[model samples]
Target chain A: VPGDSLSYPEDLCPPDNFNMVSTWIYRSSFPKKKNFSFLKKLGLKSILTLILEDYPDQNMKFLKENNVTLFQFGIAGNKEPFVQIPDDKISAALAVLLDRRNHPILIHCNKGKHRTGCLIGCLRKLQQWSHTSIFDEYRRFSHPKSRSMDQQFIELFDGREAWKVIDPKWI
Target chain B: VPGDSLSYPEDLCPPDNFNMVSTWIYRSSFPKKKNFSFLKKLGLKSILTLILEDYPDQNMKFLKENNVTLFQFGIAGNKEPFVQIPDDKISAALAVLLDRRNHPILIHCNKGKHRTGCLIGCLRKLQQWSHTSIFDEYRRFSHPKSRSMDQQFIELFDGREAWKVIDPKWI
Candidate 1:
């Protein structure tokens, strides 16, 4: 199947803002029906969602069919002064990400922008990325709606808590 | 080095506009001396460059010391109205990308924007990505300076030609 002509008729539509975050780690907006076939190709072992709502039946069905685990580290969108994504939730999420057994994982929120960006920014911090580089990556996915507060959250997130929970073999 | 506390003091500074294009394929701006240590972590086996210039001495030294091969497919920038990236060069570059032996490869140009974007766009075509998904990724990396001409080039490029030269196992 590898050298077959690239004239395959099937066209894959990845969810909005989808991109690989690193080895076995992907980030994107929530997957819709159309994105399911595309998602199948990823052979995902797990999905870590930041959305606060109950999981949709269809998505749950898809995961059950594919034998994929769900890790919900729900947090509200950072809405400036009043609302903030809890630091403990992101720390717990990082614990999931650092474990290789749950990898080939996708991280998502509604738009795959602010919340996803913040989580990824913190993950980059764990990977030892410079703040400037992490923010640049943050702004790339978030684009016009990039939030200063999310950047601040990433800047302030401490990786020490995540370190305590991670599997040594996976990092 | 896995799961050592995430308190590593050395911050990695990835080159401007750096990202993983796929599992082993990375895209970035022309790497500077400072980005060398960051690149080292990738354990790159080769670098496939699209810049139409001589490789820098420092980069050459890094490659030599690391035993990484260099594949230069120098093509002019896709400036509007006149200059265009030749179709054959991109096809040739695709052949390099399709070969797993050349993998854990880094693909770059001066800014890692236009030329690299077009190249990745075509690779996505081979992967059967929808145009919307492809362009969204293109614009994400190019940002304020995305070009219609480059997108056009990607749309028009044929992937069949690349299939002829690919190693079946790599794709």
Candidate 2:
């Protein structure tokens, strides 16, 4: 159910008036091991790395660090999860790994918008996050929730350095 | 990751299968519960009841005696990780679950296969099932894998069902 489009947008980005116990850790810029130190400050632990093949080598370095446990999924870094997720869900999933205590986590995709948003949303749902708060993140990000959401969102996955000769439009 | 399609047939069907452990349970069918009783006689503990959600009023008799957990997940059932999983991957999933010690869990979707397969595969991967065994289940069960072992196999998804009926396809 990760590919959700509409509910996810609203779920990831809800109106400010919503009441929820959610937090966002923007580890998009921090390659794998680099941010563990900062995450330690936030009291976060573990990481669910939504890796695409083209992700920079820097991120891998962090993964090699001692404290991080990886939940790696090769969804072609270019492609993102189906939709945004609620914060409470994140709370619940974190609760799963968080119960481990003070292990700072970072959920990252190459660019860290769609896949990370979707994973966090799913995690929020797992934690029983209110639907309203999930939508708040989407509203704040202000990414288009468009007719072409799938294809447009797919653009975040554009990681290839070389085009395959079989690319349809190129033909 | 439930919709994963693999290139190998063995991925779907593992050889020399082991019994699955049941950690989760659901309420579905009476006869199935009887089957659970039969398994129990063989030293298996079925933790979940399998109740056919399509027919809600049904009470699984064994559940009253054994106290199995009950749950449902729309048509997709328990396959939150994925709506549909590959055939062979799913088969391996079953094997891994069975081999687990006293962890015989019951999982189902609205019907049972899609989510069951997805969750099973996830459990298998999480449990450290071998690379060969994992591929075996994917080949044995997944329809998408039957076509081509392409990235699209992983990308295949059933569109959002609960979204507003804006497009004819949404309905």
Candidate 3:
């Protein structure tokens, strides 16, 4: 009954790489104007974006109208020896993700490949999923452009640190 | 809090290609004994399998012990001009999927690629997802082994037929 009342006269165009991460968590590439109707169907309470750039005006308007809060934990994509994703930022994002108040949230980055994948991978760790399963999911979304640096980041992430901030009841 | 009480003494190994399809629907490759502990954490009410072979004794025992109902709609894999997946079986599976009583159901096949992908693709159509978005998801799980025949089956499979049998409230 969640989405039954919503009228769908035509097909919904979900953002690229869109997929459900868990019970109320979703992941996708950066959403566009065309994807707004589809996003509305999710009845999202919040959107956690991993992009560093300022949000576009159109998206801001949509969020405002829908009363969906935005939480941005910007981290640059892991780019080899020069740039590395900050662990603290990811941990903070995990803390936000662990709260049920933010249920029905959508997590996204530019391509939803590296930054978002890394966050979901870390979340999978908290869920006690084996590294093999976590990496399998990571690579599934990353596909042709999977990054080894991102995988290493997930491997090295400390779930204990995440545990410190998250509510046990929410986990 | 849905999974908060599930104890995770050790890392859990989910079946290959396991993912949430919708609110209460999950898709994965055939479950193995090693993945039992992880499946237990899902609190599944039932499992719907698409393989033509008889259910394995071990799996049957797991379902019985866990009180998970099994719904098998056996259909041959779409193997080009020779073997075609029957439309009626997929339609029947969709009918099961659209019912809320079968909530938290796991759908699987041998590889969780072709036949499973085809079935999920049709479900996406019922949800009013665009064909481009549908095929993107199909290819993501199928990956290197994506089959055009299965994609065609999804494209040609009529959602109107599925709508006939499904409850309006569940949609």
The per-residue C-alpha lDDT of model 3 at residue A93 equals 94
Structural RMSD, model 3: 2.7
Identify the runs in model 1 with alpha carbons over 4 angstroms from their true place.
A1-5, B1-8
Better of 1 and 3 by DockQ: 1
CAPRI-style docking class of model 3 based on DockQ: medium
iRMS of candidate 1, Å: 2.2
- The lDDT of model 1 is 0.90
Which pairs of residues collide in candidate 3? none
* Candidate 3 global lDDT: 0.91
Shift in Å, residue B47, candidate 3: 0.4
Q: After superposition, how far is residue A113 of candidate 3 from its true place, in Å?
A: 0.2
Per-prediction fnat: 0.77, 0.03, 0.65
Worst 10 residues of 2 chain B by lDDT: B10-19
| Model 2 TM-score, all chains together | 0.28
- Report clashes for each candidate as comma-separated counts: 0, 78, 0
Q: Candidates' TM-scores?
A: 0.96, 0.28, 0.95
lDDT of candidate 1 over B1-171, digit per residue (tens): 443635566789999999998999999999999899999999999999998889989999999999999999999888878898888888889989978889899999999999999999999988889989999999999989999998899889877877776667766
Between 2 and 3, whose DockQ is larger?
Answer: 3
In candidate 2, what are the lDDT values of residues B1-171, reduced to their tens digit? 111212112211111111122222221112332234333433324433223344233334554556543332323233334543344444333433344342434444332323434444343343333334334343333333232322223334222321212232211
